[model samples]
Target chain A: MPHITIESGKLTDEQKRTLVERLTAVSSEVMKIPPEFYSITIHEIDDASYGIGGKCIDLVKQEYMEKHS
Target chain B: MPHITIESGKLTDEQKRTLVERLTAVSSEVMKIPPEFYSITIHEIDDASYGIGGKCIDLVKQEYMEKHS
Candidate 1:
């Protein structure tokens, strides 16, 4: 059994509700498993800790400044 | 951007290391995103809180006792 957790940007209650519904539906459709069987948790991390494509975003912005200025 | 968490039964350090490596590799293969870009956390929950298919396992065991006895 795989227990799954999804972390997204700070979400409103509406967004949270919609996401749980969508995730339940899609997970069922894709995995052929009942929605009730899945255990899901959501967490929000600070922006500084999350990065994209191996680049620390703040560092990237700094690089852009040196190159452009 | 999706942050992923995986909860499994208490895993050995070997298992944890292996899982991180495999998850990173497969996520890259399937999603075509760099492994470094994904933030993955692992948690282990108590057995009592998890269930399968709308049935609480403890309740199921209780039912089996009533039926068989």
Candidate 2:
């Protein structure tokens, strides 16, 4: 069984539902496996606890926001 | 990239830290990869949202507690 895991920022309930449905559908189509056989889990992390390029994600977001706004 | 994902019940912060450390250490030792190169993410789920054997984990836990107590 192939399990799918998504590790990223927090997602809304709608987002999570869509992700599960779409991921299962697309993967089943490709692998010729039943959708029910696939299991998908999302690991959501706060920006403060996540990092990108050795910088905290919250800090990175702040910089991006400052640059844009 | 061999990223590891752990999907399970809610874990304490200390438990999370220990998991990351131990998992990375043991896997690195076996796989000949640097500990820093290994990525570990935990998806902590409430018992109500998690299911086992077609039953909600919370319900199963309740039944177990009742049986034991």
Candidate 3:
């Protein structure tokens, strides 16, 4: 059984559903398993809770937004 | 990189923090890596969203509760 957990910043419900469907489609194709056999969960985390390079993801996102926007 | 994603039913903020700390401690002990080097994220999910054996988790929980209560 293939179970996938995706942890990322906030996403709309639609986005989550789409991700699940697309991921299942590709994964099933590659693994030679039926799409229904795969289980995927979307774990939406607040950016503040995730850290990289000792800085919170929210802060990092803000910086990235400033640079690109 | 030792990144872990935990997907489960809703948990309080305190519970989430405790889980992160405890998981890092145990994982580091087993992997022989420093605790600070591990990254963990908890994805709290609504029971209605997760499926188990063709039934949503909420429905399963309801059945379990009815039987146990």
Highest-scoring model, lDDT: 3
lDDT, candidate 2, residue A47? Answer: 58
Binned by DockQ into CAPRI classes (incorrect, acceptable, medium, high), candidate 2 is incorrect
How close is chain A of candidate 2 to the true chain A, as a TM-score?
Answer: 0.88
The local lDDT score (0 to 100) that residue B59 gets in candidate 1 is 71
In model 2 chain B, where is the ten-residue run with the lowest total lDDT?
Answer: B12-21
Q: Tens digits of per-residue lDDT for model 1 on B1-69?
A: 457787654566766666566655554444455767667777765446656577665677678999999
Q: Candidate 2's error at B4, in angstroms?
A: 0.2
- The weakest ten consecutive residues by lDDT in model 1 chain B span B23-32
Best by DockQ: 1
Instruction: State the lDDT of candidate 3 residue by residue for A1-69, as single tens digits.
Output: 899988787899999889999999999999999998999987667865664433455666889999999
True contacts kept of each: 0.44, 0.02, 0.17
Q: Which stretches of candidate 3 lie over 4 Å from their true place?
A: A1-44, A47-69, B64-69
User: Which ranges in model 2 have alpha carbons more than 4 Å from their true place?
Assistant: A1-6, A10-43, A47-69
lDDT of 2: 0.75
Rank by lDDT (best first): 3, 2, 1
Candidate 1 stretches with Cα past 4 Å from truth are: A6-69, B58-69
Q: What TM-score does prediction 1 earn?
A: 0.45
